[model samples]
Target: MLIPYTVKPRPDTGLINSKLGIWLFLASEVMLFGALFSSYILLRVNSVDWPVGSTILSVPIAAFNTVVLISSSITVIMAWASLKMGNLSKGRMYILITFLLGLTFMCVKAYEYNTKFHHGLFPSESTFMAIYFTLTGLHGLHVLGGMIVFAYFWGPGAKMWKTEPEHFTNRIEIVGLYWHFVDLVWIFLFPVLYLL
Candidate 1:
């Protein structure tokens, strides 16, 4: 059986099925991250001797990651815009750049993690380290998931643009929304975990 409203908006909700689904998912995500942020605040506030973030983390590396994520976010938007303007080749190029930027961010993060491990800075080393690892690790997982989806769309999924152009463009836009969220989370994290 064919599902209704996969691409077109529903009369009552004015949202296609996938668009509505992503928004609902993002709402739940907000709550989940909100709780984690609240916990971080409480933990930091109650600690008797909280180590400064700059002292424990490499600010320069994180700043570089911040730039990477920000650049990826820009590319994602450009990819969607190119698709909307009926430029499939341009869209693909922008998305490839976005994917490469995401890969760069993950590589830098892995290097940072390796450095921390070599220095005996495991999560169990301190309260700040535990929260830091938990928050950044979870965020990294989101980035990985986004990249997988982007990769699929960039490769085999490109076939959809030939058959169902509108749906394919919508899919790219929806993924862009998700990519923006991931970038925003990293923007918040870079400062909170690296600067102060």
Candidate 2:
């Protein structure tokens, strides 16, 4: 059976089903990441020797990835706006741009990881390394997950736009919210893990 409130807002709650679902999902994600951040802070503060993040990591590369993610955030929002404006092709183009930007961020991260491995800086090398890998690796997986969703909407999922344009737009909006959160996490991570 077709789901009610997929596109329309519910009477009890002003959000459509997917919008409400994404917000709830994001709340849980906040807790998951919050626990990790809290643990990292406690560990670092307790340790006698914590390496300066900039000394151990490539700030320039991380900064570049930051720009890429921020750009993707903008593009994803633009994609939603384009769809809302009834421009399917334009929206799809923006979505493709966002996907590629995410890909770029992952590739840069892979390069950074390879460089670390080349220098023999494995997680076992130090506490800083361990947390660094854990945080970035987890964040990378989130980025990859968003890419998978974007890919679906850009490819086979585009078919929905033909018959159910409004529904398709709502789907894009929900995905955009998730994408923005991923970007925001990196914004926090960049300074915490790289600068500090």
Clashes of each: 0, 0
Candidate 1 lDDT, 58-165, residue by residue in tens: 999999899999999999999999999999999999989999999998999999999999999999999999999999999999999999998998999989999888
Per-model TM against the reference: 0.97, 0.99
Candidate 2's residue-wise lDDT over 1-196, tens digit each? 8878987799899889999899999999999899999989999999999988999999999999999999999999999999999999999999999999999999999999999999999999999999999999999999999999999999999999999999999999999999999999999999999999
Worst 10 residues of 2 by lDDT: 1-10
The TM-score of candidate 1 is 0.97
Measured by TM-score, the strongest candidate is 2
Kindly report which residue pairs in candidate 1 clash with one another.
none
How much does each candidate deviate from the true structure in C-alpha RMSD? 1.0, 0.7
Clashes of 2: 0
Cα lDDT for residue 26, candidate 1? 85
C-alpha lDDT (0 to 100) for residue 169 of candidate 2: 98
